[model samples]
Target: MVTPGSPRGIDVKIGIVDYEAGNLKSVETALRYLHADYFISSDPSVLKKGDKIIFPGVGEARSAMRILSERGLDQFIKDFFKSGKPLLGICLGCQIVLKSSEENSTYCLGLVPGVSREFSVEMGLKIPHMGWNQVSIKGSHYIFRDIPDNGSFYFVHSFYPELDKSSQVIGSTEYGIEFSSAFSVDNLVALQFHPEKSGPFGLKILDNFIKGAD
Candidate 1:
């Protein structure tokens, strides 16, 4: 376990899964700022050893799933979640963790019971929905420990998760329509926003995950 307030998470190792989908530098920078001990890798063998995992990405769904499958990370991630360890997902990572995506009709990890759907063009909003948006907290979770209700977080995506009624929707955002912005299931927590780039509150979210998540 990582001691709280330690400069380098004294005993914790966080693995940032790199499946050739997203830019990892921002996530790395945030972890470094939190004084976390982490490594970025695509190897399942290496990632499996981490005390916690961060799965973040930005890209088209089908292509991203293809890369994960090609590198055998698809199954590895599923197994990791089944191990009941702390796992965090962001953006595309959050989308692909669902059952499938409307983006090119891609099949996803199914860790969460949902499907990713593209925002309707008729919504009259921007395509990517890029920028800081407010996330209304819907329930309690370690990741939201220090975050205020309706705190704004950075988001960049064209698709959003349409979770099952049985799924826990912990955060919701409105962009012409109300959509799930965050969800938690057992040891897994995912967000549609980018906490790393959302400034102080965002950092707080990451901090909570690193130091407070069980």
Candidate 2:
């Protein structure tokens, strides 16, 4: 949880993983607006040094996995999570945190059980759940401290993670079916939506994360 304190001297070194498949610039700009001390790196060493890490993606799951494997980041991410430092995965980045993905049958970081699968065409809903959507909080989480219930956030994805109910699911949203939109277990935090583009509510969420890093 975040405690009230001076925003300056926070000294929080946040690392945003550049796996070569995401909108990292927008995320970095949002953090900069919040005065967060951060850097963008694909190197495992720099990532390991971060007090917190943000994994953001905006492309295919298989391609993203290929990039991570090609750069040997798969193992680095796993080891980093084991270190108990806070990690926030966004968009397809959140899907890779799971055990595997059905998109290409590729193994993932396995930080969480279950696999990511594409939304069923039979559901008759849009393939990609794009545009703004409201995410209902399922439970109290440090990330949503100052955010309101049923807050709208921007999202763009065709696939969604089917996490086990036993896992800590902190937020949910409905497209064709009710599915997890965000979740956190210990230091691993993930969001299927793009909070960086979600306006003031999104900024508050980032602020809470930075404050908690202290």
Candidate 3:
């Protein structure tokens, strides 16, 4: 398995999206530790130059979208998707890419045909669902390369995206009901968990993502 260093596959101009989203520091630290070159940019033009974009967000859905809109990052992301460049969205980043979110009845980027909803407290499930959980890998996705099918990762969120059977659910974890833990379709992928905070296994996931960016 390849370690988190120079991709050894492709040299990616990595750009991390800065939309006032929390957990950016952890993500940036991981990349730095991985020896990957990256920059945190709020400017669309600077981001457009990136070969791969990382949208690791952790904030309220409505306000996050509003920030994206106000900064004109909404269209920038859309155009980036259309450009077929690789994008990795995490946590709130994952939610904002979906069709809609129950959090404040917010409409999202609609890249993934799914909805982000809160885990019901009535189901005896804890709100936020914070903690480490095992994720069952669906297929032989590049993102899962060097990572076990049932690896544990750190998660800290109340809501998750509900994907259809045919949805690009590369990794799944059962909280109360089965929910998508990670989604990968073509060049775009999103994760509900925080790989940066997930230790060595998380590093492997990020390494795989970088290698697969080509």
Candidate 4:
């Protein structure tokens, strides 16, 4: 469990995984605002040097997976997760951790046991669920300890993670349907929304992860 602490980015080195995915700079921008020490890299070796890892991604799953494979980051992420350190997933980072994505039937890292599914068109919502939405906390997870129960966060995705174990879910949100917006397993904390783009509350989430969640 995470305890109360000041921002520890000076002590904690964060690694933001880069695989040519979008939104890398925005995440970096957030870390910078928090005065966190971080580096963006595609090299597995450099990423392994980080005390904490932030996997943020955007764009199609197929191409993302392809880039990860080409750079051998696919196996590196799997290995890193087993190390049991603090790892945060944002947006595509949340979806790609699953076994596969419905987007082109692309196989993912399978770090979490589930699949990413597209929102139903019949729901009459936009294909990409953009803009702000409220995320309801499921339990007392440290990642959301400082965040309000139903805080609004920025989101820009059509696919959502449907985990096999509901016990792992830490947060949920409603689009056309209720879905897993955030989940945690061991040291991994993942959110389908873009916390970096969500303003103060979002920065708090990052601060919580960086300073407290170990």
Candidate 5:
């Protein structure tokens, strides 16, 4: 098994699953900028060999789930989480980790106990909450280790996860209402914001994740 101090000869393989729906390129660029050893693949075999898995998405939940099902990625993702390795989900990717999503009434990976619903546009709010927003971090997590408190991160999403208090919510943000911004529980972790586009603070979070991975 891999550990923090595993042999230096062993290179950690980070697998970013390509679901053909999201900003895959940008996520790859971010990892490249960090000089992280990673690979992009849709193959379950490659994913099974991943030291850590990052699921990034940006599109309709139903359509994304359809693609996942068609490619047999649904079961692969479930098994990836079951391996107890680090898993980071960004944006719509984060929504799918829960039990279900109101966006298209789709069932999700059910790794986390929660449901995602669309933000009320009737509140005179933007349909997709875009641009930079500050994240109010709650508990101490390794992911945010060296990041400053109340740091701003880029976000673009119409739906957000409604989490149970026991879910170990580590951060939150305000956009018409307070919502879960990030969470972690044992080996499973997720972020509602795009760390790849969140600038320096975001990179620090990624660094923390990479460093903490076994």
Candidate 6:
């Protein structure tokens, strides 16, 4: 039997928040391949067993915020972050974790002091900024640990985080302009790229996350 308040003797239970987001299946698939035990749930009680949380999204900002509010998950996430558990937010999930988003002027979780803005169409770059791009590791982050200093990850979004505190930006990539590609602030970490679709390099990142599930 496992000791209470110590490391639980079970497969790492990862909670994938089902908040009407996108690319959740790929997240699950990556975790499964890492031999992690996880479940997708909107219920806070069900998520109580999870050692870590993954909030991935592929949807409009306003609608996504509305859905999270309707499900009472907006506050849930805020409170959960206080517990100091490892929380990973991807793409739209990354946006909503900030104070506000330019996308429809949506207010988000305020977990990070930042704003999400869209890439200017006049910049002669792709609108969505989709496909693999090199991510320059600016500093040490738990998720990026043990990965190549220079690596590429899959990205598929137009909006990117503009952090109020530049120190939180641990990873960055160039598109039309250099934007905050990833952030790590204590227990909360968010990435604009899709590590699930990033192949071996991506998998290695996920593997590091799994190992850090303690």
Instruction: Give per-residue CA lDDT, model 5, range 67-140, as digits (tens).
Output: 99888888998888888888888888889988899998999888888989899978899879999998998878
| Pairwise lDDT winner, candidates 4 and 6 | 4
Q: Taking the tens digit of each residue's C-alpha lDDT, what string does model 2 give over 1-214?
A: 2223336445789999998865798889889888788998999877888898889899987788889888878888888888988888988888889988888777888899877888999989887889999999977888898788998999998888889754588899999998888988789888999988888887778777876733
lDDT of each: 0.88, 0.84, 0.87, 0.90, 0.84, 0.85
Q: Candidate 3: global Cα-lDDT?
A: 0.87
Q: Please give, for residues 14-103, the per-residue lDDT of candidate 1 as tens digits.
A: 999997755588999888877888999999999999989999899999989899988899998999999998899999999989999999
Q: How many backbone clashes does candidate 5 have?
A: 0
lDDT of 6 by residue, 6-125 (tens): 222355778999986879889988877766778999987777678888999998999999998988888878877998988889889888999999999999899999899999989988
The digit string of per-residue lDDT tens for model 3 on 98-211 reads: 999999999999887889989999999878899999999987888787788788999999889987545588888999998999998678899999999998989878887766
Could you tell me every candidate's TM-score relative to the true structure?
0.94, 0.93, 0.95, 0.95, 0.92, 0.92
Sort the predicted structures by TM-score, highest score first. Answer: 3, 4, 1, 2, 6, 5
lDDT, residue 88, model 3: 93
Residue pair clashes in candidate 4: none
| Worst ten in a row by lDDT for model 5 | 1-10
Model 4 lowest lDDT segment of ten? 1-10
User: Which stretches of model 3 miss by more than 4 angstroms?
Assistant: 1-7
Identify the superior model by TM-score, candidate 4 or candidate 6.
4
Q: 2 or 4, which is superior by TM-score?
A: 4
Whole-structure CA lDDT of model 4: 0.90
Best-to-worst lDDT order: 4, 1, 3, 6, 5, 2
Local error of candidate 5 at 46, Å? 1.4
**Between candidates 1 and 2, the lDDT winner:** 1
Error of 5 at 161 (Å): 0.5
